[model samples]
Target: MLPFRFIHAADLHLDSPFAGMSGLTDRVRKHLQQSTFIALDRMVQLAVREKVDFVVISGDVYDSSNTSLRAQLRFMEALEMLDREHIPVFIIHGNHDPLDSPRLAVTLPPLVHVFGPVPESVTVVRRRDGQEVSVITGMSYLTSKVKENISLRYNKKAGASELFHIGLLHANVDGNQEHETYAPCSKKDLNTAGYHYWALGHIHSRRTLQESPYIVYPGNIQGRNIRETGPKGCYLVDVDETGAVAMDFRELDTVRWFDMEVSIGDCRHPEDLRLNVERLLTDISESYTTGFSMVRIRITGRGSIHRELEDGFILEDLLIDLRRKVDNQAGTVGFAGCVWVESFCLSSGAEIQLETLLQEDSFIGELLRLAETELAGDIGSDSVIGHALRPLMDQPEIRLLLTGSTREEQREWLRRAMELTALLLLDDQEAGGASA
Candidate 1:
């Protein structure tokens, strides 16, 4: 067996319409939209630099079947670079971009090959030296919904004297519950397929189902939301002359998504908390000077400023100020990319004692007791929460906003409402006592 190296990438998701972002500057939004294309370019650049024999994308080359012309043109442009270097590119469409869907009349380069619906094998041959000993077997989805176990259909090509064999698939192996069970299969199916390596896709998180034959998912090229956080990229697999394999994971994301929880438990003032958040943002911006950061900041722990933050307008002001600071820093010489706060969630609790309030013979105590009874289901459907929230749930416009549907979830909502009501009652009592 001769030594060979190839790049394995999947879920490119080009021309993805990034949602949940509003009130962003034109520059920032433009950068967010171009992120996927940038990631693909980076992968192509890496392949050229490493001088890999070939590149295989398991599935999901585009976000949808109606992929934009810009995405198609950019994809072709990237592959053209690989073709110029004599590097072969193999691709298979996933559920997102099946063959049955309507697509633009876009053509690929001479060295590029897209696998059809039926299982087929293509041997990778080097143009300079005629070596076709490495065979790759793969198939694409004909339609968007593939409930069949496609991996079971793949088998090693017969009568092929190939030195190395690879299986390329975009499927949910072992019914990974996180994603839709399209083209589902199992580890046993792949392990017994007689392929030296399996390159997989569909799941957005990287994982290795088995190491013996190396069944791996390179994840997505770039994350589109906060749920898909951290570094996103592909794999570089190198097969040694002795058939021993070494795989290297590479980061190709141009815009990285991050989720951060900042604790203000030790801060005595709002100024202190502001400084802490600013400092953290500065560190992240300086660290990833080449890429943009979309961060979701969650404030946690008890703090004196918790009451102030509950005012709603204060949080809006804080977000505005933080974004202004980020924009200002972008003007600095070293800032190649800037950080944008996707959302600011306040989970900080108040510092008041709640046990004493529940014992009082006043409005706060009455409300708290009612909340406890309803939460325990002592009042049943006629409970205060049930009556008050029933109308809101009945309204079609507001129904979508209330996502919590379970009993425990209802209890949590009631509990939070009671806490806020108690705070107001306490303030009112203090004011009455001062006048009397």
Candidate 2:
């Protein structure tokens, strides 16, 4: 068997809308709206450039349960491009786009092979002499909710050691908490399946469970939310004549998502703080080249300007000004890209010398010590503060804004409380000194 290569891509989520974002400019929104399709085009371009023997899309090619005509047409168009190059595309429908879906009726080109609900095997041959290159075994989702361990259904046929066997599946292995446990199976179950490689989907984070047999998830082609941060794309895999497989990741995301933290701990004035943030934004903008960059800047750490930031109007104005400065259009410099601040979260505290203040043995020091003691111990959910917070935390929106979701979060909440108390006491002392 001669060495051959193929592209393994999954979770395309075609025509998917960006989530958890609002107040987007017309141009940015339009660019993001078309990003998924752009990523698909990039994937096709990559496969053609790499001159892979074939392409395998593990699952979720479309975002909707009832697939849109536009998505169907665009998908067909991409496949047609590969078809023109005499490249074959193997696909398995995932939970998002099950075989039972009432999608737009469109006939795929002959080069495209879609797996059905039942397990099937395909022998891909060399285009030149029709010599068998590999055997691909796969199954598609018939319904959206398939809780059964579908790995149980796949059994490797005896014989044919020379032919490389690849298993294409759209499943949640060993119960990934991030997504529903559809077509769930254990790592051991897949390892025992006897295939050389398992191309998996469902979870949109790339991971390799085992290296020897290569049980892998290629993640998604594009990121559609803040949660799906970083470079998103597919894997280019090569299987040698000796059956040694090598995998390389190729980034295809048109729009990138990032969570950036800018500390204002040293800034003494508003202008200094603004410059600090601007420098950070500039640095981030220069880093990404693909298209647009969406960033959520978390302004954190103790600073002199914390009091001013606590005033709602001030933070709002700063956000408006920062957006204009960062997201403004820059001419095509390739890597120099447009960066938009999706949201600004102020987690910074007021700058105060806590240890010196605590040495004074005052009421403020007592308050600080008390908070420290409480934080050192259990949060005491049965106590007065916790009881008061229970009702407020029950509301989803309020809980989202609240920090204390877990024990670690409770500690952070206590820390922030101590900082706030210390700041307020210092301000009171300053006011008294001025009056005297």
Candidate 3:
């Protein structure tokens, strides 16, 4: 048996529009809109540069079934580049771009082989010897939803022992809760299939579950949102003559996404907070070579600025000022090329510590205890404060907000409310004292 090299990529999701984005400059928006194509182009370039024998796209070449003509043209151009170089491409459609999809109307090059609905094997011969070297067994999604365990149908053992066998699938393996359960199958199901390598798709986070008989998800070639943050790319896999397999990840994303939490526990004044924010943005910019990045920051921990942040006006003004500072530093040294803040949150608590105040035997302390009891449900639903929010909580939107919320999160919210109320009262007292 001879050694071979190939790329296993999936979830191209071409021409996917950014979701829940705001405050973008026209220049940034343009780059984002074309990021998917840019990522795919880089993959093709990598394939050519590395001189791999063939390329395997596990699934989701397009964003949806009704993919735009522009997307199709761009995809064709990339594949054509490989075709001109005499490199072959194997593809299988996932639930996003099923076999019956109307968007697959565009014609592709001869070197491209798209697998059909049923599990079937296609043998490729080594160009050097004209002898069969590898067999690729795959199946495409016929419809949008395949509830059955489709892995049961793959028959890789039908191939001869001397050939390398590869299995391609776009399924929700082992009931991955992050993604919709489409074409569900267990890891055991794939392992038992007796393939040398299993190329998987549908979940957009890369994982190499097994090394002996590589079961891999190369993730999506592009990260479309914050949830899909970090490096996005494919796997360059090499199989040696002795059947030893090795895989290396190659990053293809032009724009990187990051979420950071900046603590303001020691920030005693607004200027102190401003300096802290400036430091954070400056540090983040220099951390990545990608140059362009999207960031979401949460300002957390107890601080003197908590009351001001809760006032809304101060937070809005602070955000505007922070953006101005960041915009001025775009393309400058010690900063990511063009960094954009998606949104910010003030999760800070008041300077007055809640734990210390809880120990007092006073009216305010009693109120704090009551609030904590209601928050923890220690005061049952029969209590006055428990029923106070019951009607509001009954609303559909409110219930939706509470859905999947942990007890810690609920308690945290309650603590924030108590802190805010106490701060307001203290501010009122100070005003009264000054007037007197």
* Number of clashing pairs per prediction, in order: 0, 0, 3
Q: Name the runs in model 3 displaced over 4 angstroms.
A: 127-131, 321-336, 357-389, 393-412, 421-436
On lDDT, the stronger of 2 and 3 is 2
Better of 1 and 3 by lDDT: 1
Model 1 lDDT, residue 128, Cα: 55
Per-residue accuracy of model 3 over 55-168 as CA lDDT, tens digit each: 999999999888878888999999999999778899999988888888645678888999999998888765445666789989999988888999999987553888899999
Residue 423, candidate 3: C-alpha displacement in angstroms: 4.7
Local error of candidate 3 at residue 194 (angstroms): 0.7
Instruction: Evaluate model 2: give its lDDT.
Output: 0.84
Tell me the TM-score of each prediction against the true structure.
Answer: 0.87, 0.88, 0.87
Task: Report each candidate's C-alpha RMSD, comma-separated, in the order given.
Answer: 3.7, 3.3, 3.7
Q: Write the per-residue lDDT of candidate 2 for residues 100-137, one digit (tens) a residue.
A: 99976678888899999999888887655667888898
The TM-score that candidate 1 achieves is: 0.87
TM-score of candidate 2 against the unseen true structure: 0.88
Give residue 143's error in model 2 in angstroms: 2.1
